[model samples]
Target chain A: MFKDLDPLLHSQLRLAVMSLLIGLESAEFTFIKEKTNSTAGNLSVQLDKLSDAGYISVEKSFKGKKPLTTCRVTKKGLRAFEDYVTVLKQYINK
Target chain B: MESENQILSTEQSLEIITRMIRQAHGSAKRNSVYLIVWGVAIILANLGMFILIWVEYPRPYLVWLIAIPAWFATFYLSYKHRQEARVSSHLNRINSFLWYSYGVIIFTIVVFGFKINYQLNPIILLVSAVPAFVSGTIIKFRPLIFGGVLFWLFGIICFLIGGPWQYLVGAVAVATGHLVPGLLLRNKNDEQHVQGS
Candidate 1:
């Protein structure tokens, strides 16, 4: 059922981010940046796309005097990820 | 009004992604506060017990039993909070580590204070390794795995050292092992808060 949905999440960068986030309750911008090896500009764009699709959420705050950004995956996102994985399995099985 | 088929601008996409991540986990401020409070209380209780032992107090063993109820309290509070806020598995894993640490510390003090003759080497190793192992497995944290290895080494050392020094070594082992990791976790939590805003 979800096999067809897997490709929606298979993008190299987006998949990396999603995979990392799936394992975290929340992750700091720096952590994600380091993990994905993506620039702030690029990562920000990808994050926005995911958020628009209801896959993740981003919060911006000031830590001391510095700007801090953190991200967490929503329940909707989790469901989508699960569905996506299920879809991917069908393709693999075939 | 030019064309409806145009894709979102890069900036717009980024904004949407950020929002999605934000919505992934609900507000954890309350849970964070609860955990901080719990950590402080546990530290205080341990300190109190330590002082009591230093004073040659009686029935210091009873202090250990306080953990049983404390565990229940923590469970209840966490359960209640879980209903109010969506806590990630990562946060819960860290919380579990904290509680397990507290339990082990209290248990160690109680056993040692009462002059109980139980062989503590294996028990201590198991207690310390379990949380580290779980953390590593669930969170894929190398630091925790390394900490677990250190604990195992300490356990072996305790067995080899034997005699009175075993107590001192055990104290040092735990202080360095669990306490250090707890402190590191607290620091990480602080960093997250800084990042989370």
Candidate 2:
């Protein structure tokens, strides 16, 4: 039997964000927006969704006068990503 | 970017993952600033000391004072780099720890150089090789690995040859080991920037 893909990670932008965050210690909000080629509003919404899911942690702070935001994958997020990839591989091989 | 809930095919998901991971790799690009700054500073100090000693200057060691400004420059540049950095990765932390540990160890050695009878050149060169070699291996840069080996070789030679000549040898060691590799790294960084643009 084939396992269903995680709905949270089945979208384009969220998957891209997770893929980017997976290899990094942390990444700034602006960096995610730029890399994903998404508008600030759209990226923020997706990040919030992931943050609410406990798949990632978001920290908001200030860099001088400007507010800076950074994100990292949580341990649970890592496990989820790994499981997602394994299921993905299985699907591809089938 | 697609719509908020736009579902992706398995192939599309895999493609996004691959592409994003490739983009993340850019964060790991080595900054050549520290290498170049220290390389030039060392070359200047070694050659300055050698020239003054050859000219019979009463305080040839005063040339070592050149390090004060270099330290300030490094501090400023590092602060600027930290501010500008968009992403932090494991490789970045590893590189920072490698250099920070090197600085502490070298500082300790320099403070106790007199206890070792001022046989500082050979000891300094040998100590310098560890970071260079490991950093090269970490970044997969062959020139830095060769530079590290050259440092080891020159360090051994320093032990064989004594006195003022050791200062001259030290200059050559840094020129090949530090300066050359630093310049090559800068060149590679520039090429990458141009291509990226």
List model 1 lDDT by residue over B69-179, tens digit each. 656777788777644432345656575666567466846654684465755544565566665555544434445557677767877787777644554555555554555
DockQ of all candidates, in order?
A: 0.09, 0.90
Best by lDDT: 2
Candidate 2's residue-wise lDDT over B1-197, tens digit each? 87867768899999999999877765223466778888888888998988998899999888888888889998998898889888888877787899899999989998998899878999999999998888877666778889999999999999999988898899888888878887787777533421110
Best by TM-score: 2
Off by over 4 Å in 2: B27-30, B189-197
DockQ-based class of model 1:
incorrect
True contacts kept of each: 0.11, 0.92
TM-score per model over all chains: 0.46, 0.93
lDDT (0 to 1) per candidate: 0.58, 0.86
Instruction: Please report the TM-score between candidate 2 and the true structure.
Output: 0.93
**What is the Å distance of residue B106 in model 2 from its true position?**
0.8
Candidate 2 lDDT by residue in tens digits, A1-94: 8899999988999999999999889999999999999999989989999999999999999999999999999999999999999999999999
RMSD of each: 10.5, 2.5
